[model samples]
Target: MKEIFQQYTGFIMLFGLGFFMACKHEIPVQPAPENPSNNNPVDTGQPCDPNTVYFQRDVLPILLSNCTMSGCHNATDREDGVVLDNYANVMATADVRPGNAGGSDLFEVLVEDDKDKRMPYGRNSLTEAQIQIIQTWINQGARNEICGTSTCDTASVTYSAVIKPLVQNNCSGCHNNSLASGGYNFSTHAGLVVAVNNGRLVGAVSHAAGFVPMPQGGKLTDCQVSQIKKWVNFGALNN
Candidate 1:
C-alpha cells in the first residue's frame, strides 16, 4: 500500500496544481491619474491663488485676446452696445462689481454659458485658469493695481514679455519708422510715447483727426491697448 501511494503522488501533485490555477482570479490594470503639472506643458510657473488674481497681468490679457474683438467690444464698433475697450469700461457700472467675481459679467459670460451666451461668441471657450483668474480678480476688489503692490513683491512683468511684440505685430508694420503713418511710429518706446503725446495713439486708432485705426483692417485688442497703457504708466520701461 505504501508503494502504491508513492507511485500516485506525482499525479496528485499535477491535479492539485491544475485546481489552483483554475481558482486564481485575473485582475484588470488601471492607468495612473494624471498630475496637472505633467499633463499641461504650458502651465504658468507660479502657483495660482484664489485670493489674489493678477488683474493687470493675468486677467486683462484674456479679456483682450478673447472678448474684445473689433466688431464686438472695440471702441469703434461697440457691437451689442458694449464697449470693453479699456480699464474704465471694465470697472464701470455694467462690467464688474469690485470684490464680487460671482456678480461680474466677465465671469458670467465665460463661466455660466451655453456657447451662445459665451463672450468670444463663436470662439473656443475660456480655460479653467483664465476663469479662475477673473474670479480671483473680482474676489480681490478688482482694483486696477498690480498684484503684490501693497504687500509682497508683485512680480515685475517685462515689457518685452507683453508689450513689445504686441506693438510690433499690431502697429509696427504700419507705424514703424519705415512707415510712420500719421507721423506715428510705434516701433520704439520713444515712438510710442510720441504718438500718444501727439494724440495719435489713444482712443480708437481710427479716431479721425483722420488717423486710421491700426493693424490695417483690425482694432488693437483691449489687452494690447491695456499693455500699452501699462507701459506708459510704468514710464515705458525698456526691454
Candidate 2:
C-alpha cells in the first residue's frame, strides 16, 4: 500500500508540471519595443484662415509675384501657353477649379516635386502661408471677389508696420535669401534702399513705363500704392 501511494504521488506531480508547461506555452509573447530614429515628420503648419483669404487681396499677389513675373507665366512669355496675368486668363489656362485646389493645375505646379514641371520653375518656391492662401481661395470658390473690408491705414503707415509686412508677404518669396530674382532683393531695408535709389521700387509698384510692374501676378491696390508713395516721399525712412 505505501509503494502504491508513492507511485500515485509521483504521477500527480508529473501531471501538474506538464499542465504548467502547457499553460506557459499557451500564453502570448509580447513584441519587442520599436527602435527610435531621426526621421522628422512633415510640417503641415496651421490651417489657413478661411475668413480673410480673398482672391484679389491674398491669392492674386502670390500668383503675380511668383508665377506671372517676366519670362515666366506672364502675358509676354506665356510659358507652356499659360498666361496668369489676369483673372480670366488664369482661369482659362491654369485649369483652376473652384472648391478644388489639389485638382487645379496652378496649385499642383506650385507644389510639384519635379523641377522642370513646377510653377515658378528655376526660382524660389512659395511659402506655406502663400500656398495655404491659394488653397483656401480655391476652396472658397476661386471668385474674383475682393476683400471689401481691407482698408489701408495710410495715416499711421510706417516702415515696420506697413512696408515691411508688404514686402515680406508680397515680394520676399523670390526676393529673399534664396532666389533674389533679377538680383533685386527686397527682403531688407538696405536692399529696398538700393532699389529705391535706382528708382525701380517706385516705378515698379506704380506700374510706370520702362519698369516692370512688380508683385508680378497683379498690381498693388491703389491704397497700397498711395501708401508706398507716401513712405518714399517721406524720405523712405527706416522708422
Candidate 3:
C-alpha cells in the first residue's frame, strides 16, 4: 500500500513538471513597441502667419514677377541703375526708404499714373493686391525673412487655378511679353502652349537634361512640380 501511494505521488509530480515546461516553451513572446517620434521627425516650431508679408516668399516672388525682365531690372539690363532681382540689389539700386512706401522710388514707379513711364515698360499693370502686398512689405521695414509654411494639394489642379498663378509668380518675370527670354512668353495661355508643344515647359520646369532649369535662384517644391505636371498631363488645356 505504501509503495503504490509513492508511485501515485511521483506520477502526479512528473505530470505537473511536464505541463510547466510545455507552457514555458510554447508561449510566443511579444516585441517592444517602437517610438514613432524617433523614426520620423516633425517640425515643432511656430506656425507661419498667412497675413504676414514674408520677404523670400511674398516680396521675392512679386519682384521676380513684376520686375526682373530682359530690359527691366534684370542683372544684365539694370535699367535706370535699378536692379530688383535680389534683396541686396533692390536695397542698393532702387530708391527704397524702408518703412516709407510713399517715399520709396520703387513704390512710386509702381503707382505711377503716366502710362508711358508706369514701369514694367509696356506690359499689364500690377494687380491692386500685388501693389498692396508690396506696400505692406515696405511699411513693415522690408526685412529679408523666410517663413516656415507649406501646404500642398493636387486633388483638383487646373490651368486657371494652379498653373497660371504658379507661372505668374515664378516665370512671368523672365518670360512675359516684355521679357520673352529664349523666345518664350508665359504671360498668356496661347503663349504657354508654344513651350508645351515643343516640350520646353515640362523639361524646363522639371530641371530635366539639356533644358534650362526654371525659377532661377531656387527650384520648385515637389508639390509645385507635381501640380505643373498634373496640369500638363491633362492636355495642358485652357481650363
> Residue 201 of candidate 1: its Cα lDDT?
65
lDDT of each residue in 1-239, candidate 3, tens digit only = 99999999999999999999999988964322122112221232446567777666667777876777567788898888898876777776777676788988888888899988887668777768778888987887766655555667787898889888888877886787766878989989999989998988888878999988877755676788898888788888898
Each model's TM-score, in the order given? Answer: 0.42, 0.66, 0.68
List, residue by residue over 1-239, the lDDT tens digit for candidate 2: 99999999999999999999999999965321121121122222434334756556676667776776667788888888998766667777787877788988888988999988876787767777778888887776766654334445788778998998788667876687767888988878888888888889889988999998877555787888898888988888889
- Output the better candidate (2/3) by lDDT: 3
133: Cα error in model 1, Å? 0.5
Output the lDDT of residue 60, model 3. Answer: 73
Local accuracy by lDDT, each model: 0.59, 0.74, 0.76
Total clashes for model 2: 2
Looking at model 3, report the run of 10 residues with the lowest lDDT sum.
32-41
Top candidate (lDDT): 3
How many backbone overlaps does candidate 1 show?
2
Q: What RMSD value applies to candidate 1?
A: 18.0
The top-ranked prediction according to TM-score is 3
lDDT, candidate 1, equals 0.59
